[model samples]
Target chain A: MIKFEVDNVSVEAKEGDTILGALRRNGVNVPTLCHMEDLAPTGACRICVVEVDGMRGLVPACSYPVAEGMKIKSRSPRVIEARRTVTQLLLANHPDDCLYCSRSGNCELQTIATELGVRQRLYRGQRATRKLDVSSPSVVRDPEKCILCGRCVRMCEEVQGVSAIDFIGRGSSTVIGTAFDRGLNVSSCINCGQCIVVCPTGALTERSHVDEVIAALADPDKYVVVQHAPAISVTIAEEFGVKPGTDADGRLVAALRRAGFDKVFDTSFSADLTIMEEGSELISRIRNNGVLPMITSCSPGWIKYVETFYPQLLPNVSTCKSPQQMLGALIKSFFAQTQGIAPEKIVSVSIMPCTAKKFEAQRPEFAPNGLPDVDYVLTTREAARLLRTCGINMERLEPDNADTPFGERSSAGKIFGAGGGVMEAAIRSAHFLLTGKELSEPKLTALRGTKDRKEMQLDIDGLKVGVAVVSGLGNARTLMNEIAAGRSDIHFIEVMACPGGCVGGGGQPIGLDRESVKERMKTLYNIDRDDALRVSHKNANVQRLYREFLGEPLGHRSHELLHTHYGKRDVLR
Target chain B: MTTTVDSILAEYAGAGRDALIPILQRVQEREGYLSTDAIVRIGEKLDLPAAKIYGVATFYNQFRFQPRGKNHIMICRGTACHVKGSAKVLENISHRTGVEPGRTSRDGQFSIEVVACMGACALAPAVNVNGHFYPKVSPTKVDRLIQDCRDEETN
Candidate 1:
């Protein structure tokens, strides 16, 4: 540890800690806009500038290393003035439409400005008019509101390993853009909205479908049904000032019903269905000498990443659709049939913790006979807004159960919200399919947590099976390269594009730190631990659906409704 | 054309990202501008994303993304030239050529660009066309310059 004097208060921090890190550790609040935890500091924003005892000018605390005996005044008058000037400059070029911005109440810039006492615009200048890019089905880019913090760029390039956007041009003309300043739809974007979560300003957001959903809800001709992802119920509580990871599942269903949905269902039920098909597919591949090391296709962003970067591995991906689409397809096929409603008149809406599900729902394969399976998708944030718009406080609502038929799900399905969850769920069912028995302890402790990559070898009925789970596309890319290089130890792989899987997905509540995501994951695991039905195959409703509609797992009807294939996609490099 | 990029990339075989600038420079030099195909090929060879490659290439003003026209006109916009009314000279040249700065004409015959400096401060309001410098250029002289280029093309 090294000793430093911050505001004349002695503090000790680890040896290589930056001034910002040390000050933060010492309970000193230093505001920063361009700083991201666990990322290499760029020191682009000078908001964290502080007065060092011997420095000629105020130095940025984010990138400056803490030295022994160094005296730092983090809130000195000069430092405050520099920070105010930086905020003023950022606001000078920023748009004045915060009232209409999607991030009005939650914008970091507005909060920082209010904290710095920047009541009025001190320096007004011509705001550069930048084009609004709304080409992608998932994300929206309002460049006029961007402050050039480069957080989105770094998150895309460094964290996600998808350099779909970057700082184009230089000087005052610099803007974050895709290749050739083209639309993001044509770029190498995997539609993982990680960039949206990191943007400090209102520059990046998920493309909203709330208005369309409201229109559908009001239409008497349409039978609008809604399903919420497992991660949504856990994280949506944060938007309502509840503690993070609080399971508001029943409250969320009640809230959706209050919002005028004809019926509310759970995506976890379809997640159980996914495990049934995906697990059976894994065993068939193992028994029939099919594609070894078959990768999971639950995350649409990972599927798109493979389609764009590693097209040769398309055949290796499991043919099962994601839970969101699986439920959508079932809603139109089986649910509509059971209700005696025309498929065209049924509007399927999904509330997801993912932005890629919006893109996934719009894929051509998901649409049949010129009719889309899922009509609209709302992020957890958007769902909160929708509920608020309807004057329904989600926290105060009475807990209610989801509709019958497609509402019952096993705890194994509920755990699909976390990273390595699908693998655990699949292993449970795959073990049952292979050896006609369940694991003595169903909880695979090795396949839990938010680690980048996890591996486990299991002997199921004397068959040695290797399984791997990875979240974050960068880690996925590394493992993929190893597999491509003929490392064939693994028989099955599960990959989620976001870091911690659906709980840390791109379209969850904004401004969430890693701790909140971990809490949400813990909540999912807690749900699994407390629940009775823990295996997907044991879910009575799913088994009934297989008997009533679909013949069996990997059957022709399942192939038609619950499974899909991927092909090579050409994108701007 | 793709074969040319492939051959150029062959010289940098077994190289890494350190060879990016040199590869881009060579490709741009050979193609007169960096095409999308060339950039994508370079990205593949360097094992880098094309967006990042484009980002790096665009930071410096040495790269162009479009094919050069037959008559490439560069107008100096340095401090010395600006004080001597190079902006009017640039406008007059753009008017005569019917092309915006840093863009090719519709007919692919003329292109215009505003450069920072050519190091000929003594001759203010300078214009260079097709590697030939015209010192102390006026807005009216832009007409004659276009005519001379047209005549040279005919010859």
Candidate 2:
């Protein structure tokens, strides 16, 4: 650590840490938008300008390094003026429609506008006009709201390892976009929604299906069934001002019930069903000389990344749709038939911690029946929006259990919401199924945690099964590169596009640090531990669904509804 | 000599929509006023093709895509360059070159372009004459910078 004194404050910081980091460590709030903690500092915002004693002019604190004995005035009149002018220049081109934008109260641009005291636009003749890019299924782009901070670019390239978009041209004419300004749906976007999470303005937003959800609820002839993803239980509390990582599963079910869904189910139950199918598929592949490195397909982002960048690896990806999609397919097919409702009258809804699920639902092939498998997808954020619109205080809602027949799930099912969670959950059932004996404990510590990348090998029935788990697209790139280089000997791989899986999804609450994302992921594991049935095979709901409805894993019925295929894409220009 | 707007538009749209950037760069690279039609036609191809393209084209100080005189002069307006009296340097360049930024000499011999944050902070008050980095430039050095470029053009 390097010790430095700035403005008589002695601070210790890492060698590569910027002056902004040092100051922030010492409780100094440096104004910045381009300096997110998870991303590398671009110094583009110019909002963290500071006055140094000997320096000729103000320097951006985020990019400038702190030298020893450097005296700095963080909030001088000159510094304030420079910062305010920079903010004003940014606001001059920014759209003034803050009140009606989705991110209104929680927007970083709004916070900056309040901080800078920008009352009105100074340069009004003609601001740069850009057409709204709403071609993507999951995310929308309003270039008018873009400040050219390159946060989305950095998030896509540096974090997600998918450089599908970049800044073209120079200076004021510079704009961030996909290659040839192609529609994102046509581009190689994985639909992870991390870009929306990092975006400061209304430029990037999730595609909403509120009207469809409302239509489902209003249809007296329809039976609306909702399933909440694993991570949603932990994060829904934050929307109600509860502490981060709070487990409000009971409250979430109650809130969904109050929101007027006919049945509030658990995706964890479907997650168990996924394990039964996926686990057996893995074992069969090993036995029958099928694909060796079978990759998990829970994350739409990872799946698209493979399709776009590594099309040859398509064979490695699991043929199964994610648990949420599986539930949607199940609800529309077997559940609908069993419950005496027509497939058209069964409106399936999924509460996911991801924005990519929006795009997943829109796939033409995803509709098993004449109607789409999932009628609508409500993100964790949208669910909270619905609850708030209904005037229901999430914190005050009475605790209630998930609807029966589809509600019961195991601890293994619950853990699938996080990184490495599926591998751990699958092992619990697979080990029992293969060995005909239960393990002392189901916690696969080797596969757990929020590490960027991890590898482990386990001995099951004298067979050494090598596995690798990766969270974050950058890490996924490293693993893929290693595979490309012929160094990857792992039998199975699990990849989540977000840094820590769905707990840190693009649709989750913004402003969570790595530590906070880990905390939320831990809550998922804790929920798993508290459950009596920790193995997927033990879930009675899953067993009954298989016996009465689907017949069996990899069966004709299962293949029709639960499995999916991938196609290659020309994402890069 | 006068150039038609059609040729410039065709050249800007020749490669791709993003081709306008290098086209404008080439225009500024070649003759030295951004043809307004070049900007308009480039916008037309991009679909967002708006008049604001002109505003942004003019906003940043570094664009000049037109025919200039025999000699073209550029002065650095970067932050460190600004601190070392680049505004005064601009005044002196205007005095010597008989042209301000985005302007050409009445005799059609010299054009001027000013830029921001040229990445040469260590050498404050920097300038590039005919694609050569001239660091630590001052008002006194302006006359020589112009004369050297003019001398090269004549030679």
Candidate 3:
């Protein structure tokens, strides 16, 4: 530890800590627009400039390292003026339609400008030409609002390991775009939308399907049915002013019902269904001398990334549809048939904690005919907006249960919201299918954390199975290389493109740091622990679905509706 | 099998990620611009993403995506040349040549590329045509410059 002076108060800081780190630790808050806690500080925004003794000019506090006995003023008059100037310059070229912007109150730029008291734009010049790129299904790019902070760029390249978009032009005309300035669909972008969350301005945002969903809800003929992903119920509390770590499961169901959803279901039901199919697939592959290290195929972003970057691994990925797609197919096929509603009239809308689910829903194969299995995919944020529009305060609603038949889910399915939850869920079900007995403690505690990669081996009735769970595409890439080199010992792997699985999905509440993601993850596990049925195989509704309509786990009807194939794609295209 | 691009890529076959900039530089030098095919090939050989390669290539002004014309006109618009009415000269050239800065004519006979400085401050308005230098050029000289390029293409 070293001693330093911040605002004339002697403060002790860790050795080799930066001024920004020390100041933040000491509760002397300095404004920063370009800083993400997980990313390396590049000091691109220059909003955190501070005065340091012996330095000729104000230094960027984010990247400037502290020394022993260093004198630093976080917000001296000169420092405040410099920060104000930076904010003013950024605001001068920005669009004046803050009231109408989608990210009005949540924008980091607006927050910093308000903090610095920069009410007036100091430098006015030629603003960047306004161009909207709405080519990608998940994310929208409004280039005119870009402040060139490089947060999106860094997030995509460093965290996701998909260098799909970057700075394309030079100087005043510099633009961040995909290769050759082509549409993101044609580029290597997987529509992950991590870039959308990190953007300080409204430059990148999720494409809105709220109006269309509302229209569907209003349509008399359309039976608008909604299903919430396992992660959505855990993370929706943030938008309702509830505590971050609180679970909004019952409230979300109650609110969705009030918002005109004909019937509300949990995706965890199909998550349990997915476990049955995926677990059976894994066992057959192992027993039948099939593909080893069968990778999970639930996260659509990870699926697209593998398709673009590592297509050869497609054969190793499980063939089961994601719970969202599975539930959509079931809602349109099985649920529609049982309810006596035409599949066409059933507008299958899914409230997902994922942006890639939007792209996945739009996939050609998911819809064999003109009508798709799922009509619209709304993010957790969009669903919250829909609830607010109908004046349904989720926090105020009484806790309720999801509708029956497709509503019941196991604790094993609920845990699918977080990283390694799928693998943990699969291990429990696979153990029962393989040996006809449960593991002493069902929860694979080793694979429970929010780490990028978690690996553990379990001896299930004399059959030793090695499983690896990876979240965040960057870590997935590292594991992919190992598997590509034929050096992997893992028999099964679960991959979620987002950092902490669906709990940290790109379509979840925006601007959520990893700390909040961990808290949201706890909600999933807490539900898993308290639930009566803790195993997927024990979900009575899932068993009833199989017994009534679907004959077996990997039977003929299950294969037709619950399974799919993948084709290779050229990344350059 | 022995195409110029193939040979260019073969030289960089084993060179890793750091070779991206140099590979792009040489490819652009030889091909006059960085084609999508070339960029994709470079990415494949270097084991890097095409978007990342394009990102680095675009950071440098020397790289171009469009093909250069037969007559590459290099106009200096540095401090010394701009003060000597190079803007008007540039306007005249653009009007006569019927092309914007950093673009080739429709017929592919001529192209205009503006440079910061050509290290010819003594001339104060030097315009380099291919390798030949024309100093102290004015708007009146624009017609002759186009005519000369057209005559050379015809002859």
Query: Model 1: what is its DockQ?
Result: 0.80
Q: Report the error of model 3 at residue A222, Å.
A: 1.1
Candidate 1 on A135-214: residue-level lDDT in tens? Answer: 99999999999988999989888888999999998999899999889999999999999999999988999999999998
Candidate 3 achieves a global lDDT of 0.88
TM-score of chain B of each: 0.86, 0.66, 0.86
**How far off is residue B144 in model 2, in Å?**
43
| Better DockQ candidate (2, 3) | 3
| Residue range A120-166, candidate 2, lDDT tens digits | 66665358889888888888888888888888888887888776677
Q: lDDT per residue, candidate 3, A1-573, as tens digits? A: 999899899999998788998999999897888888867799988989999999999999999889999999887899988988888888878889899888888899999999878877678878767679999899999998999999888888899999998888788788899998898878889988888878888899888899999999899999999999999888888877776778888988998888899999999999999999999999999999998889999999999998988888999999999998899898888888888999989888999988899999999879958779898999988888888787887777898899988899998999999998999999999999998888789878899988899999888878898899999899999998998888657999999999989998988887788789989988889888888999999999999999999999999999999999988987673
TM-score head-to-head 1 vs 2, winner:
1
Candidate 1 chain A has its poorest 10 consecutive residues by lDDT at A388-397
User: Rank order by TM-score, top first?
Assistant: 1, 3, 2
How accurate locally is residue A75 in candidate 2, as Cα lDDT from 0 to 100?
A: 73
Error of 3 at A182 (Å): 1.2
Higher-scoring candidate on lDDT, 2 or 3: 3
TM-score of each predicted structure versus truth: 0.98, 0.79, 0.96
What lDDT does candidate 2 reach at residue A322?
89
